[model samples]
Target: MNSLQKGNGSVVRRVKLATIHLLALGVLSGVVVSLHAGEAISPRRLIEVVDISGPVVSPDSSQVAFRTEQASVARNTYDSVWYVQNTDGKTPPRRVGEGGVPLRSSAGLSLPAFAVWSPDGRWIYYRALMDGKVGVWRASADGSSAKPLTNDPADVRNFLLSADGKTLNYSVGATRDEVIAAEQSEYERGIHVDSSVPIGQGDLFRSGNVEGRLATQRLDVLGDGFARVPLLSGVPDRWKAIDLLTGKTRDLEASEVPSPQTIASALPKGESKPWRYALDTVNHRVALLTRVGDQGDLVQKPGVELSVLLGKNSPRHIECQAEPCVNKAISGVQWKPGSEEVVYTVSDPAEGMAQSIFRWNVKSGEVRLVARSAGLLNGGQRYGLEDPGCGLSSTALVCVAADANRPPRVEKIDLETGKRQVLFDPNASLAADISADMPVKLLRWKDAKGRLFTGQFFAARRTGDRPPPLFIAYYLCPGFLRSGYGGEWPLATFAEHGISALCINYGPFSFDAVERYNQGLSAVKSAVDLLASSGEIDRTRVGMGELSFGTEITMWTAFNSDLLAATSITGALLSRSMYLHGSLKGKEFISRAHKVWQLGSPDETPEQWKRIGLEFNLDKIRSPVLMQVPEQEYVWLLDSAVPLMLDHKADLYVFPQAPHFKFQPRQLLAANERNVDWFRFWLQDYEDPDPEKKSQYAVWREMKAHASNRGENPAGSRGD
Candidate 1:
């Protein structure tokens, strides 16, 4: 008989006569089977994936408390709700906090984002905006007795309960008022004044000939562009340690908190963005992905470091890039279930290099190889902002797991032996519910430059005779279902409509403008050629789309190739100036992307700007395009969009003021919905059922008539 370890450390075994239990379950409807995957995804079932986020298993492992958010048409915003379910998944998750007053954040973000169960399992503590700012709130396990647990003046970004269940630690960002006051105080004290002048803006004017600067040598920047932005102060997340029972907070002001700015700039050896820490009190240890300053050269920069902390002991530095170590950034880490061992993931940058998982034993101080090409396929985010709660259970780890042939799946990995068990199947169930898996296969190829590229493809089924229309949805999709709430392309939804989706991941390009553009664009062209050569997807009906970096690539591809029949983009600035002048993050991204390809900075290499800049290449675009950008980002878009729109070759869609990564669910859903409509009309000639889309179709049909008269067809002419 098979044996299993229960959460309470009791051993359970299957009876000799297992057939009787199966017969009983078959006869009784009340006896439920867990993981009853319902149906394949379609436009109708898009809501199914929306509510499956932040599944937190209770401390006892008997139940799970997860957060769910849905786009509400009636309310014109997304609504956040919590759900409780048995760990076995036998029972359908039931919504909690019901009939209580609904809560929404002032920023239109859903409330109660991350939910964690109290040690006693009698309460669930979650982050929710109370009176315009986020604070911790607790609700009874049954969703009643909802009350505030902490009253912080600012939004709490992250919080966690200590292993002993006595210390509650959290982090919060500085508020606008705090930042302004600090700036004013500094100015009054004869410190540097904040200025609105753009970085390198003065250098160009200081030199009589701007062209001379680009042609001859690098312009000396007066100061770092982003570091000058007072609001962009590179402060670490401010932490607060609170006594759970007394509600007494011990803040930075009371403690000897290290100066984040000084620590960040002078990090000894660590070189990533900022240090992030996780505490495991049971082992009296803390783990941090951080950097330290070099004593010889304060300005010398380096990569990040992985270190461990023991009680009153200096952090035990784990050499991740030395002999007997991997030369890559530590991707993720998790404490072994009921143990002091830390499991982590890391990857190399070379082509065909797979992400690997490792286990570091704190007591033994030995890092053991765990799994190679590990669970990278699951849980995607362009920026790893929110933690997806990838952790361990009593005996196994429930996380996103993947392999070469299969996409990511919710899997349970044995913590000790590393054997895997599939807990949820979003693919095969779709095959059972619909017609076939529209089986997905890994697509591997090389660019003209011989740079290796890889992605995924959905095999076409159920469509008769006609080659499947192809749509390329991109931006570093590594695994199966994604974790974030916004900006995700509707891949499965496209597959359900009988259109095959090619999720392309390109070469990790450096910042050189030409190489970045060429290597990435060539990879995409190669993927398309492979698909077309297979005679599985129609070449003429090809379409492409992206948000953020993908949008920039789409523009470059449209300019470089006439292969795409249609495209959608989010980056719609009139010149490279906006990209160079926008958010610090965007500016750094542009600079790094260009530099990687041997391209110089804009101030030093104006020629490269003229080549890869999207605004300069609009005339070269043969495919019709759709421009969907946020209102805050429309400053330079007018000059760009009017020219494209005036040609009747593009459409400009303006959304409410929202950051690149932050979009209201309603807006995100609407964008995806409209994208589907645009592709359907242009690539498949399938008019949408919604009447609101009729005018759009009419315009598309008129464009079609013009194209037909000119002897062009996105889809091959039926006459052919």
Candidate 2:
């Protein structure tokens, strides 16, 4: 200003005046504003997560359709939609056109989801909301031209499309309330979720043919833009359509038949009882699956022949074309690609666990050995039947094979020459990617009783070294262990972090839901004793983790036993009492809830409930535990669950928003990573104690160090 020229004097004065005005404004506001954030941010900051689930491949197999929620950058919440993407995972998926997310309310929790695909794969047929109500909608493969396919008021259970894409096949209904009542009865009788009876919603409708108007309407693919068909299948809604073109939907050929007294005497008690009904297909063939006392048999009428499929002599081979060709030697059957031939697993029922694959010509009634892929007819591990859908082509079928120590391996079978090739071997993958030098052993032990129990042990690569922290996972159902859907992360993630893992199957001693509800305590005890006796598991450093109903069992052990050094219970079954009262305490198997809770409900039997709750006796658990709950964890933990644990001072973490299921890869990965770290901290401490526990100044020094590393005031920063 002092050096300003005469010609610019007015400009200088104006600039000084503007500076004074800015200072005045700042003084008036009494706050300083900056564009960038400071060092620390909120720990609760929301991150966008994707739900890439229900993968559907297009006819060309070049594109895949899936459902997920996309984030609103401003609002910070996601809306659901059907999206399409390249199958190779190369391209990012885009929405199938613009539409509002279907509102999930108390009236119905079922939202529109991917259901069927058209013949050409150019369109993804789904049940979505068109206005404010629920209905079926179809969208182009690329998320374009989304239009309604059905306008049924009742909820759509599932859907199918004709090969020509001109007809849409679907089933619709309300949840089976009666089936739920029956389930409640079992729970009341001390049956847990796993032990409860399984009743199909269709069973509720089985009283008669679906009580609905039935007729098929031709889908005009090119006209009407998009058709909105009414709800078809089941009772109450009473809207159904029977296609005249394809034999996809029609009335039953015959009523359900009662089990013969002899068959009933042979059948297993409880839910193993089977119902028989006839499916009226194009050929007027009748299909029946019935269970008697201990024996289950499947018979197709017109042929008036039967084969046992589940209980005794469970029929595996049945040619249902004209002459009824029945073979007691077969156990599992799958219709071939053309639906002409049936591939069956044939073996002697008395052999316990053995079988071979055979092909039966339905038209010719000729049975021939396709392959002797040993254990095809084996009762225990090989009970899973081969189906034509698993085949990559008309000539090859995909099969899964497993042993006690290893997970199942996928294989392809050639029908013509009976050659077999391993498609993807989990065992080989674990060895190659995890360790080659480590001694991996599959061990079996019998508890005090003579029954056998199986476990997998991964010893240190070097000789004579105690295995790193041993972890156990009850992945599969006790009854279905060999081919069960095992727990996902504990086995693979633990290996990734150089930790030894043991997968224990608590089967034979207690198999199926009824056994699970009845004998969980004994089964767990047996498994623990067997594992400890082997001396392979570091008894002092062992950690346990399980999910779904397994979480219920694991928590029971954590509460009662001091064997586990650390534990994780995801999707916990915290309360049985609430589930039965229908107060939304937890999600339950519709058919099994009624009778299952009586034995374990805290309200009914205080002592038993105390044991089951795991909260009342948290002090008994010596291990540092981590309990993660999803935002909507009604499937397991209810409103009372978290508070009960908190009252007991249990270590817990809550995912602000998450689902009951574990199909999300990222969330699962994060959980696994945290588990590995927690176990490592506890187990590694067993070998080397943290010396920093000694000095008083050590705490301050560590704090300062942390602050320096974190580049923030450790004492002041609370991550926000």
Candidate 3:
């Protein structure tokens, strides 16, 4: 009756981990232990998605073209497919695109999703690989005809269709010499390569007869090209506007370095305010947004300058911050369907701002706020809304509305009536699946410092003979798990096996910022106090887990607080202060992140190095720690990893060449396998579920025995 509720029903994994290794995986291992197919989502079924993104509502509003991704065990990652669905919800979604197109990358089997509906609703235009080349393709709305529209060998990386359905503005990557020459030209101007330099001393270098491009961006050595920064703003790389009817193109963005000032003064001037049409739609006008300055930071005011190009008339600058324009960061601007009102959204999370939606009348040039409910915190990347608060269907608007209690859901905000109605319940299946096994609730609490925080709480619906263990995980956890970027939290697996989960958004969700880190620590404190006082969490069995910067919080909580029995941390490290700036070669990411988290250099933040930085403070950690790292992560973290495993009561799991964002399905399942085992044994004295596994559990047993011998329990003991 409750199969999926109790376990992830059986689906054979490509690289199944042993029971002990699975347990170390923490939350997911419990599902596979007693795996089978069922209604609700389990770790085994984590591959499914509730929301379909990049939805293009057709002109008549009869159909919606969108895409979704599903995990593929064959590829060890997620692959995408496109679908068309009736907006009225009468008919089930008809799958338009399928996987099985072979590709060279590790993401082996599948097609890319660039699907969009043609303005007339007769066809759907998308980019896909065909005959060893990636090009634009189209399919009829009724699914009767499908064929290649553009055959370009260079491959279209990104493209958009014109309003008249006659033009395509596409961008392609730079070529080998193009990339190298840009890097070399920029480097020569910044650093004078005299006779002392390696190149200057070479026999060929002494002569000016060599080819203009000798290989740069390290492409000659690395075999991978790196792009040089553009010399001008609002210019696309290798941009071309093609007339689909004529098979001819006008070069809109030329990649050549601006001619030297001396050479430029001798030449004729071109158009003064060059514009690249972003959406040259059938809607009868061209819309373009250009960065204000070369810096291109979108968070600041006046970040972009908007330009409108009418038929033959000159392009005009649409004032962004003048008399009638908005001063807040304009994150987006889109022309309303069949109207002239330009809708935009403001996302300033640092100020606790919701995503306020506004509209500008192109004829009157008057800007006004239409919908001010972006929620206190916005997961800006989710759902891929063309207009967050306003998707026009003739006179009505479709929106993803949100509030403190509800995650963003599709709704129609009626402009005339000022009333809102639910449009689509994307997560209905997901909500039913997980909620069947676990009772989910929203939790709010105040820390000792008197700051209020909120988080999502989940526990088993039926807690039987023994009180359940607890695990707290967090990071920018706003509203619904609808985006389907990262799979749902392993709450179902955890709850079914007697574990509860609480995830919080650590202050507006900023990366590498000190202010957010402090807020995360405070939120963790509040979570611990609230969960402990509720008496639902087994006092001795409280564990914790974190990914990315959440590891920093894990480090602080493990060392400073005595709430957790065990913990897992990944994604990033806490030892940025251990290495000097620029020490890790080609590792400017580390250097920048370090500066954002602290001041000056590792040498300057010695005290902070010991407090929150690299020093590990391993001697003080009360909970057993587990750290899983990807191969591509920086090496300095390994320096901290050794001390954590060898000296402290911690373990490490490292995946080869795995990207930090997510693991291959095989690796991910194994990781979850290990986590479930870790929490199970530490919190409930449960051993390996599979009797065959030995070495992994043996090591953990020794760690537990060692701790037990010392008469220590991070949280209250089982004796309690």
Candidate 4:
């Protein structure tokens, strides 16, 4: 049975946190602890926090629709729920449909895939996965009922609704004849070996015994050397439309479908060219938003230029009179109702990464501030009313916003007064508990290269006179500090257990891969110096955790400097073996790798390979390393991990059927708990009391003994 009550003119649905603890502990065994007032966040609690996204306003601006996703350990996957709330804050949000759409790309789940509201504001339509098939679905806004609009066999990748609400157009993947033939061949015979399929893709096919052999076979038969076809390539997406009046569906001709970018025209030529633009049909003018710097330069000064083009007249640049006018970037550009004004959002990195909404009068050329946020607006990377995570209306702006401590929540801002009202908070209780235990402080520092960088420092409560060990997670630290980008390391949990942590954002990168790695090394060293000088942490006991690009930097730091006591990476390293493995993907991938890494065949570029390759620098690394990666990436680690394992300096664990970013609840919990244990053992010389980890501690103890025999210290000491 469930219980609900009324709060603030809305129904508040509450669940017992103890139930979550029990469920998590029962599934993952020793991964979660009981939650209580003032208790610190655990690995399971962080995974269970609701991730809210796709906030879209109704056609009449009377209500907003959004989705929430949370990890379900029992199901071993994520569950998404959609809800509808009145924009006026007068009524509580209601659960609309059974679930929201599941939109995934090659990389994995893409969030903020908005649901389209019906013209009459009575029904909201979205794409969802049912019985392993993706199709369009709709639910009554009043939460009375829900049903599917399209039941196509092929997965619908995208869709659009006509203004009149009488028609809906959708696009789905169409299998090619070659693909079908290849699949049939694989079914009858084993997979055929070839260079056309990437090693990762081929391994996936072989592991699942599924149908990915066609693209590779096609390439092989055609002898299309240097030309690469994706592992799942087929004909272009086919479009279909449904007529609501007659309840009929039909294929759409190419000419009947408009281009995806019909709203914006060609970009103008200039140093500050706009990355995004919009057209005003009513006034016959255009609005462009540009960032003032080289598009590829990461450390350029923060500045933006908003210009308007009226007829054939010269472009007019709108002047911003507001203080702190330096803008890092601009997004969400659009013409207001009646084309009287243009509205856009600007993010100021200098002001704690604050975002503000501004309106520019086309006729008078006056810029006025509508609303501002000390944290993020709309979402982290993109900011726009048209964005799936935000919506705009004549009288208000609704978006998903959050800061370093708070989780994302739906907030409605009054357009006129700039007043903000919280419409819904999905993680209120969890956020409160975490915030109380671990407080964040914004940190800014410049590396030796004079490049500016920012970070979030989560301070731990000191339990003794000696400083606590510091843990560093690198790459991007935007919005909430939810264990960095991949959520691989539990930052709050670390701080609660007496390990201070810092999440550093990478600065401008160099085209030269070696120099870029050096930059990351400098940034990490600078951060350690800053915290140590302030008596906030013990720099000698510093540990690091990373994913993707951060893993590269961690390796470089380990080889180039002895600043790290222990390191954990959730990715594979780049090496000679990896280059050969990547060649299986095709010529284009190999070409891109050459350009990015400036590496060729080892026979041709021995010096280049020896300079940055992991295999060549393993002898220089003194810190112990932990490798936890997806099964797809596990093979790439063999070159380095095999050597390190023999030397008792590394450990590797792989998650089956996992993507680059692990999404399974059990896998995520295991990774998180393993990371926590690894850092504690190396940095603090502490071990968990759980008896299940007895064998795990035994292996580490042996590694520690081996390190001592080699005249090395696994744990940091006062004197080297």
Best by lDDT: 4
Q: In model 3, where do residues sit more than 4 Å from their true spots?
A: 1-41, 74-77, 99-114, 129-133, 174-236, 239-335, 340-380, 383-391, 396-430, 461-467, 482-489, 508-516, 574-595, 714-720
Q: Tens-digit lDDT track for model 3 on 1-720?
A: 000011111011111100001111122111112222245445544433322344566789877665444444545544544556566655555656532222211111122234667778888887665544556777776656677766553545567777688887776555434444555665666634322221211122211111111222110111111101111111234666777778787767455222222312222245343222234245445455554543332222234565554433443445545443433545565666767766666654432234665666667777665656634222213321222224456555555454432333455455445465554443343444554555566676777767667666777543465667787776544334321112323655666666777766555333334455566777876776666677777656777776555666667777766767898865446455223322322344344435445544556766666766535477777688776655434353666667766754878776654433343567666666677777777876776658665777887877777677767753423632
TM-scores, each model vs. reference: 0.69, 0.51, 0.67, 0.86
Q: Model 4: residues >4 Å from true position, as ranges?
A: 1-36, 175-184, 190-196, 206-233, 258-274, 278-286, 291-304, 309-327, 337-339, 351-354, 379-389, 584-587, 716-720
RMSD of 3: 11.8
Which rank order by TM-score, best down to worst?
Answer: 4, 1, 3, 2
What is the per-residue lDDT of model 2 for residues 58-119, given as tens digits with 9 covering 90 to 100?
65556656554333333432345566655443444556743334322111111223446677
Of the candidates numbered 2 and 4, which has the greater lDDT value?
Answer: 4
Native-to-model Cα distance after best TM-score fit, residue 605 in candidate 4, in Å: 2.7
lDDT of 1: 0.53
lDDT of 4 by residue, 463-502 (tens): 8887889999877665666666667798988998888989
Q: Give model 2's clash tally.
A: 54
Residue 439's lDDT in candidate 4: 79
Q: All candidates: CA RMSD in angstroms? A: 12.4, 20.4, 11.8, 8.3
Worst 10 residues of 4 by lDDT: 1-10
